[model samples]
Target: MKTMPVLNTIKKRLSAFALGVVDLVVRFKRTTEKMFLPWDKWVKPEGSIAREKLFSRFPRYLKEPAGSVRCGEGWYPLVWDLCTAIEAMEHLGMPRIGHFKAEERLGGLFVRVESGSFIVKELARDAEHRAAAICEECGEPGSLQLGHGFAKTLCQLHAAQRKPHKVKTVPIPENLATQRPKLLFLDTEFTDFDYPQLISIALVAESGESYYAELENGWSREGCSAFVVEKVLPQLTGGEFFQESGYAARRLREWLAGFGVPIRVVTDAPGYDWVLMLDLLHHELPPNLYPTPLNFYSESLPELRPLLKQAHDDACRDLSPHHALQDAEALREAWEVMKEHLHPAILRQYLKL
Candidate 1:
């Protein structure tokens, strides 16, 4: 019995040594594989390993032989685990994956797999749901952020580096300046879209004359939206231009009266800009100003829409946006670039000239 106990102890030691050797060999194989791989294929600039292993391990799923990974590196491990689980389903006699594609869509992971069971779809969805809380760039905890007309998933650190989408500048045509029917491009910065109370108003005439004013009272800061508070309020310069609502209205009327010619107000947002202007004027618009504001929108002239946007972007680059005066100037620039493309019939309908 004593000899048998000693023999059993020796056997246990040998088994432990064998397992250790196996683990060392596995680690060495991975290290050697990385050593032999191309420099670019081994690591990315962001410090994440390249997706070559994923492709090589699941060649049947990833059809693309060579290309950058479709999603962020933070989600790489999740993707690898998902793929492993999917391949394991083969033991259950599940159908083979005919096609597999994964990408980021609207700040979330989206995976499409052709020829799979309900369980496969559930797996993909679960992965996506989990990805919403995982930073796409560094795999840290993250959330979906929406701004500048796009959405992205990022952690606080990575989100700070994201910039708003830039609007491309469109050069104004050399001979496309309008000389007829005085146009006043208007813009207003208000408290909120739901119940907007004018914070400031501006009008830029085609002849270079302009009017701007900030309301000193009647609007509460509590009613302001996050966008208005951040982008609009900070741009305000409250000096001589700041006045009471009644005084501001009188100033605006007097300014409109100075323009002896019939003037048409042009604005991109008629519902907000035009309504706020009318409210400021106390429903008694100047005789020289047109009763109906001219709607400047993509639907008004589809062909000139891109040119108008480009011109506005160009103006915004020169002057800060969100300020009523600056926005009005931008609107005027957009009108000047796009007016030449307007049909005479459409012009007559709006200008009545």
Candidate 2:
């Protein structure tokens, strides 16, 4: 009879231990689900909790009768819940869930993971797309507010600060003691893979004066290399403004002369066009006119990488049917957009800026 009591006591203790192990396993599975699922899926589209939803808190994990559990410190639990709920709404394609760390999308704020579906993904993508989209190259929440100007997105810093763009007919300011020479906007057209050749050139002057220089059959390799020699030999060369009957060569030289003093020679691709001008005309353009750009290619500037996608999309929108002048204008517009968030004054001092 004493032996029977001992056996009974051991059986009861073993049953209790088995129940404890099962409880622990259940709690761990719940925590894992809470940490990974789309938090918003549990809620309605408007972000209000559904009537069918119920939550009960325990010492370790929150128990849900449905299929998942939620737990974490701060607003994390709530965020996780919202994300999970949103994912459920979107056919159970869960978001990539985790605590917020470094981000260029939300201005690095701690954003709760919601759904990572098409809609939410696109929004997130836009946030980090435009690397050089800001003047100072900042993003996410609490950073510069993005504003639109001339159909371009400007961050808080650069928006509404510049003088309105002047029309071609607008005259110079009357207060000028010295006459400012008119600037000419010039752009060249060439195929993507074309090496050394002249296709077409569009020259637009400040007074809205414009012209095109089209070669009879375009320049060949030898013709492009020694253009002034081979091409010029076959045509009449020099006068005041009408120098050389070959309209392209003479007009280019006249345009170059306008840079007697410091001036801004705006172009879409300064690296390429500027190089061509130097090679063809054999003249060194003034340095001040060509400000070094903050391109994504620069290893020193990493902030711009985060914004490239947005910048490219914006450029594409404004440059649907690509042309030399259109691309140039698009680039100029991009600069304006970037300047809105990143003030040139502050950005100039830092290498990364």
Candidate 3:
């Protein structure tokens, strides 16, 4: 009877310890789910039964229940197939996907996974390629359609609803061309907007001398954006224009040397085009080339934007736009048309004319 109280006290303590352990495990599981599952934060499609089934079947891969699927209903099959493939490989030492998000970008499916294996990546790539040909709105055969400032993969019926915007063209002002500093209008096509790697570059001088080259190597086709693959790659003329990167750089240097004067570089996208050009030159700018590049879309030249667009439209009427040489030539034409309309103060501020 004396030892019965001690036994009862020990049993109560043991029960409390067990309960505490269970509570800690529950908290840890919740924390892990919150940390690894990000689908709840993504933009999901409405009334997606496939998404619900995906989450239900792959609780280990997709832990979030609240968020909708980030893509259209047409892509549900692709996502489902991709997830099924990934699940099949989970036991084979592949890294579990901590976060997953799928969306349409540049008329193609772009799937982002925080962690995965080589096979997983390949599966994702295959799905994206398939998505490029399938309509995002409905499960129908489709092609990449280019609009005014957007691109989409749509079937004939859906594409009919989204017509390309027409831009008005204006006549070039021939008499008021500013002639000084020898401007070289530059343009470059690259792999993608997020991380651009130069595929081709072109420079069109004010005097009508032009240089254009396509890189023979140093860029992977897999890294190109859907927009680039559809719009830019088809325009490449791979005869004499294609050269190795080092040879292209050397040839570009030689071309700059031929000018025999300090050339001012101008581009609409100085951040990308100018940076890539500098990298191609090995960061050692030629003495004849100015250190700073002039941006045609600079904030100081707000009045020139409309005219520049019109001139580009006019120039591109006969020539294609995505081709680097043609784009550079279009930039030169825009500059020719814009200079005549710019106030003297603005011209002096940029060109010192």
Candidate 4:
């Protein structure tokens, strides 16, 4: 009966050795580590394995491959020195038994003898494909779509789309030309009066013989009818003296770009209106605008009278402050009130008129 225990022990030892061989073969065959895995996954590093023991010590191999030590799909074979074989076994859970290099098993995983050569090639190919798909504009993944309209692997949102150009027209009054540069009148309407939140800008500028303008985005309910009536009409008619809004600032910055000269953006108070212009030019305008500081301050216009009285009364009674468009109109009215009283040369020094 005692002999039966010894005989059973010998049988168990032989079974363990056989099972280890199976672990080695299955892991070695599926070795694609030389090729790139998907971006979402990572591989265990090589060189983490200790020296291999004789087949007897690993008794669990007799039963089955350990469910706890299951191999990941991405693991590949690497062989040369025992150290690499040991690394594959311990770190990557790969086969380390037998002379795989001599048997040509290693060649199945890698073209060369280098340990990580397979992974290197696969990763390189994936990187090149990713780089080719990136958009030059806006710098977001798949934002730009170019070339073919069909036969694609990635989603449309990840692709870039081309945008068209649009341009609009606005008039510049002849009277204000003498006090400021050949100016561009810009304006914007917002859905709300919230700071740093702009919905759209309406710009008007003179290009050589004709005037050009455009709106950045179409006006919304929060920005349109009331804004045009309360804001736009006042500036055009010279009923108010200040209309400091996002639309005005955008146009001012755009104008400053083409002309190398600094522009004096006239407002009712140079201090108040100019401050708004500086903020728009420095912080809000696009990179193409290339804005620098320019002179801004309220230069009292020639026409000062019943208009000022009305403006002051409105300011006191309305509670809500009138902005840039109103100021544009007020400036026009003020000039009409005093244009004949001012020196012609001084007017010529500041304005194109």
Candidate 4, residues 188-230: lDDT per residue as tens digits? Answer: 3332322212332322333321112222322223223454456
Each candidate structure's TM-score, on Cα atoms with residue i matched to residue i, is 0.47, 0.32, 0.49, 0.27
C-alpha local distance difference test of each model = 0.72, 0.38, 0.72, 0.33
Residue 268 Cα positional deviation in candidate 4, in Å, after optimal superposition:
3.5
- CA error at residue 119 for candidate 1, angstroms: 70
Model 1 superposed RMSD (Cα): 20.6
lDDT of 1 by residue, 34-151 (tens): 6896644432224343466666665667746422247777887667656655665654477776567788776789887765476566666667888999988788999987653346
Candidates 1 and 4 compared by TM-score, better number:
1
Q: Which ten residues in a row have the lowest lDDT in candidate 3?
A: 164-173
Model 4 clash count equals 36
Pairs in clash, predicted candidate 3 = 44-68, 44-69
Candidate 4: regions farther than 4 A off: 1-196, 199-254, 269-337, 344-353
**Rank order (by TM-score, best first):** 3, 1, 2, 4
Task: Give the C-alpha miss distance for residue 89 in model 1, angstroms.
Answer: 86
| Residue 196 error, candidate 1, Å | 0.3
User: Between the candidate structures 2 and 3, which one is better when assessed by TM-score?
Assistant: 3
* Candidate number that wins on TM-score, 1 or 3: 3
| True-structure lDDT of candidate 1 | 0.72
Q: Ten residues in a row with the worst lDDT in model 2?
A: 161-170
lDDT of 2 by residue, 16-126 (tens): 564454345435544665688564542223323322242322211223222233211122333333333333333333444333221222222123233344433332333
Prediction 2 TM-score vs. true: 0.32
